[model samples]
Target: MPVNDTFGDVRITTHRDNDDLLSAGLGLRGLAGTATRFVQPASPTPEELRRRAIQSSWKGIADLGPRGGFGSVYGSIPHVPGREFTSFAYLPGARASHRVLLQVPDEFDHERRCLVVTASSGSRGIYGSIAVAGGWGLPRGCAVAYTDKAGGAGYFDPADRTGVQLDGTRVRAGSAPLEFEPQGLAADAGIAVKHAHSGDNPEADWGRHVLQAARFGLAMLDRAFPHEAPFTAQNTTIIATGLSNGGGAVLRAAGDDKDGMLAAVVAMEPNIHVRGGRSFYDYATEAALWLPAALSARQFDDVPFARVGAASPPAWMLRGAALRAHGRLTSLMPGAQAEEALAMLRAGGWTDEVLATAASSTSLDLWRAVAVAYASAYLKRDAAHMPGGFSYRLQHAAGVAGPIDAIVRAAWWADGSGVPPGTGISLDGGTDLSLDPTLPGVLTLRDLQTGHGADADQLRAAVDATAAELPREGLPILIVHGAQDGLIPVAFSSQPYVKWLRDAGRTPVFWKVPYAQHFDAFLAFADFGDRHAPLLPFGYAALDRAWAHVAQGRALPEDAAVRETRPRGAGPLTAATLSLPPN
Candidate 1:
C-alpha cells in the first residue's frame, strides 16, 4: 500500500495508533473528534427541500428579518457594494454563527441567470473575498458571496466558550441556527446565502448549508427577479466552486446533493478525496503551507473577530505573527526563542529584512535561509567551525532558530512523512497567545493543546466531521488541483477521490496544473509572483465547463486525466498534456 492511500502525512503502518500525534503534530492546537449532523443525501423532494428551506428561512434569515440588522462595510463604493451579513453557521456551540462580506457587482446580470458561490479555502489570505469581489465567480457577471471558514470564524476569544457574535445576538446552547440572507443579494438582482459556521464541521452542519443556500438563493432569483431563471433543484443547474477547503466543500456539497441543484462543481486546488484503501498513503507525497504576514495581510474584515483591522493590537500584530511562528519552524528546540528575538528586532526596526524575504521567497526554506543570512551579515569572520565566545551565543540565539514551523508540524503529524495536509495551526489563531509588540509569539503545538481553552471533545468532533467527503456517483463534475500545490498535498483528493468515484461508477473529470500551486500559474512559474492572475482563467474554465455539462448536458472530452503545463519562459498557459491508460 502506497502512502497516498492513507492521509498524506499519516503512514499506513502508524496512523491507527497516532491519531493524537497526527493532530498535535499538524499544529491543529485543538482536540477535535469527527463531526456529527451527517447528511446521507437520498434525493430530497422539491417539497422536502421547499419545506425545509421555508423552515430554514423562518429560523434562519427570518430571525435577522431582511437585511435590516446587517451593515454595509464598503461606504459609498460605486459598482461594488460591499456588505457584511451576520448569520448562523453549522457548528457545535453557543456561538456557532458566521457571516459574509459580500460583493454585489454593479454589472450583475439577472438575465445571465447564475449564482456563483465561492468557498474561502481555509478562510485565510484573500480566501473568499477575491473570488467574490473580482476573482473567479464574480467576474462571470454574477452575484458573489464570501465568508471565513469555521476555524477562521471561531478563532477569537481562544477560550472554549464561544466568542462574541458579530450581531450580538444571544446564542442558545444547542446548535446555533444558520443565518441565511438571500434577499441581501438584492442589489445584484440575484441572491445571498450564509450557511453553517465556517469552522471545521464539528456537528457535520454541512448537510443543510449548501442545499439551503442553493434553494433559497435560486428561489429569490425567481421570486424577486422573476425574469431571472426559475431554478428549483430539478429545473435549473447551480455551480458549486471553491479553493482548498472551499474547493473540497463544494465537491462534497455537490456529491451529497447529487442530481440536484448543482449542475456541476469546480474545485480549484481543492483537497479532494480519493479512496483510502488499506492504507493512508497510496504513494509517497509532499505537503505545503502558506504562513501569515505574507503579502497585504490576506484581507480580514474590520469586525471584532477579525485578526487584523480595528480590533487587534496596533504595533505588534504582524510582527507578533511572524515571531509566534518561529518555534514551529525551529520546533521544540533547546533555546533561542525566535519569538523573543524577533521582539528585539522589531524594537530596533529590524523586521523588514525577514519580512521582505517572507513576501518574495517561494519556499519557507528560502524565507528561513534569507532571514539567517541577513541576521548574520554583520559577522566579523567568514563561515568556520566551532567559534566559542560571542559567535556561539549569536548563532545559537538567532541563526539556529531558522524556520522549522511547516517542517516540524508536517513531520510530527504525518507519521514522520514530513508533509501534512492543510495548516494545523490557525494563522489568525496565532493572535490569541500573546500581545507583546516585540515578541508576541505565534501559537505553538503546546499552546494549541494546553494554553487556549480549546474544547478537546469539540475539536475532535470538528476534525472528524470536517474530514473530506468521499465523491459518490451522480454528478457531472470537474475536479482540478494545481500540480504545483505545495499545501494540502494533492494526493489527498486526486488519487483517493478518483478511486472512490471510479468504484462508484461515477466519472468526473480531474485536471492537474503542471505549474499551479493551489492555483495554477502561467509560463515559467512553478507557483509564485503575480499569483492571482495565473489562476483566474483556470477557475473560469472549470465553472464554464461544469455549467455547460450540468445545464446543457454537453459531453466533456474523454481524457480522464491531464496535466496543464506552460512554456519554460514567461507566457500564457500552454495546452494540457493528457494521460492515457497503458494499452
Candidate 2:
C-alpha cells in the first residue's frame, strides 16, 4: 500500500537536502548508469564559479545568492508600494524545510482577500515582471505570491543553458547543478532554524513534489498572511494558477484538495496529457523539447546520432554540430524513413547549402529541438533543489522513464508489441485499482524502477498506474493553450482534459490562443529571452474572468478569440509583433 501519512504540526526549517552535495553525487543523484549506459551531470557554471568565489559572506550576507536568487527577497520586504517581495520557511511535507519566495501585490489586503499563490519564472521572475508581459497583475485588483518550487529556480531561458567554458571550448548553456551553502543567507534573511538540515539539487517526483507544493500554499496562507478563507474563484471559492510545471502543480493540488481547499485551477501549457509516442509524436513539441538535450548531451560526451552506426547508439543518441545538424537528425531513423524525411525537406527547397547554415535549415532547428527534448524527458525535466540523493533522483527517473518508455513503445510504437494498451480504464486486470484521488492513476517516481513486466497484464497495470487523474467537482477548470504551441501540442495536452471534464459532467472553460506558441515568444524576445515566458494573455485573461466571478459574481467571457501578435519587422520574433512565416 502507498504511504498514507500527514504532518502533525508543520515545522519550518532552513531548506536542506538529505545529503551534502559531494555525498549526493556519490549517492542517488550521483554518477549514474554503467560505463555502457550513458548519462552524466555537468561541471559547474559561471554562476557556480561566482558562488564558489564568494565562499562565505559579504558583510555577513550570504555570498551564494548574488549570482542567482538573492538580496531582494531577503532582509526586510522591499518598501515598494502596492508590492512587496519576501521569503519564508515552511514545512510542506513532514520536516521538509522549504522556502517559498513571494511577491505580494500592492492591492493585497491581508485581512480580507487572499493572494493567488503563483510561481515566478525560473527561480522567481513573475513577481518582478512587466504586466503587459503577463505578470504581477497590477492595477487589476489582482494580488500575487509565488515560490521557487525547487532547484533554487528553474533554468534561465533558451533551454536553461548559459554559455560556459569547458576544455577551452564554448559550450552552449545547459542545466548545470551546483551546491551553495546557505548559512549566511539564511541567517541574514532571518529564516535560520536551530536544527538546520541540508539539501542539494535532486531529481523530481511529481507526486511528492505536488503534495509539498499544495501544503506550501496552505501554509503560506496560514503562516504568511492573515488566515482568511483565501481569495476565491466564484464556484470553487479558492483559486490556484501557475505556468508550466507550476501550472501542472495547481491542477494536482485541486485533485488532492480533499479538504476543499481549492475550487479551480488555471494551468497554462501543462505537461500532462502528452501521449506515449516518441518518434511519431508531436513534431513541434518534440523538436522544442529535444533542442536542449542536444546541447546538454555534449557535456556528457554523448555519441552523436550521426554516428549511430558505430555501437547501436546509446539511449539518448544526440550529437549535433551547428553545421551537420540536419543530416545528423535524418540518420536517426533507419533507411527509407530517413530518405522520406530528407525528400520532404528537399522538395521544399532545402538544398545542402541551405541545410549547412543553422539559421537557414528547418532540419537543423528540428535536430536541436529533439536533442533538448530527449535530454529533458530523460535526465533534466524535474531537476530541482530537494531533500534527496542525486543518485536516487536519476535512478528514480530512469527506472520510471526507461521502463515507462519501453511500455509506451511496446503499446504505441508501430513496430512495437502487437497488443496495444488502450486509454482510460484498462480491462484484463492490468490497471492499479487503487485510485488514491490525490494521485490517481499515477506512478510515484520511486515506482518507476520498482517493477517491470515479464507478464503482459503486469506491464499494462504499470502503464495505467503512471497517468495523473484527479476530481473535477467544485473545481471549475479554465484551460488556456496556444494553438501554435511548440512545447506541448494543444491537442494532446488540453483536448483530453476537456474530455475528462465533459465525462464528469463539468463544463470547463477551454480557451485557445490564436498564433500563440507554447509561450509568448514575442514578449520573451523583447526581454532578450531571459526567462521561460508565460502563455499569451489568454491564461491571465481567463483568470481575470474567474476572479471577477469570485469577487463579485461577474460572468467570464464565453468562448472567445484571444490575439497574440508580434510587431512587424520582428526577426527572431517577440510577442509585440505578428509571428512571421517560416523562413
Q: Provide the TM-score for each candidate, comma-separated.
A: 0.47, 0.47
Worst 10 residues of 1 by lDDT: 279-288
**CA lDDT of 216 in candidate 2?**
47
lDDT of 1 by residue, 1-583 (tens): 1121111110011111222111211111111111111132222222222222112211211111111111121111112322222233333342234433333343556554566655445433212324322344444555544434332322211111122233322122133432321111112121111112121231143333444445444544454346655556554445667766566667667656643566667776665443332111111000001223322232212211223232333232344244445533332321233344333424422233223322222222222221111112112111121011111111112335344432222111111110111223211111234443212221222132223343323332333444455444566667766554444445445656766777778787776554444422112223232232234345556666666665567766443333333422232222232122111
TM-score of 2: 0.47
- Candidate whose lDDT is highest: 1
Residue lDDT tens for model 2, 195-216: 1112321112232434444444
Each prediction's whole-model lDDT (CA):
0.34, 0.33
RMSD in Å for model 1: 20.6
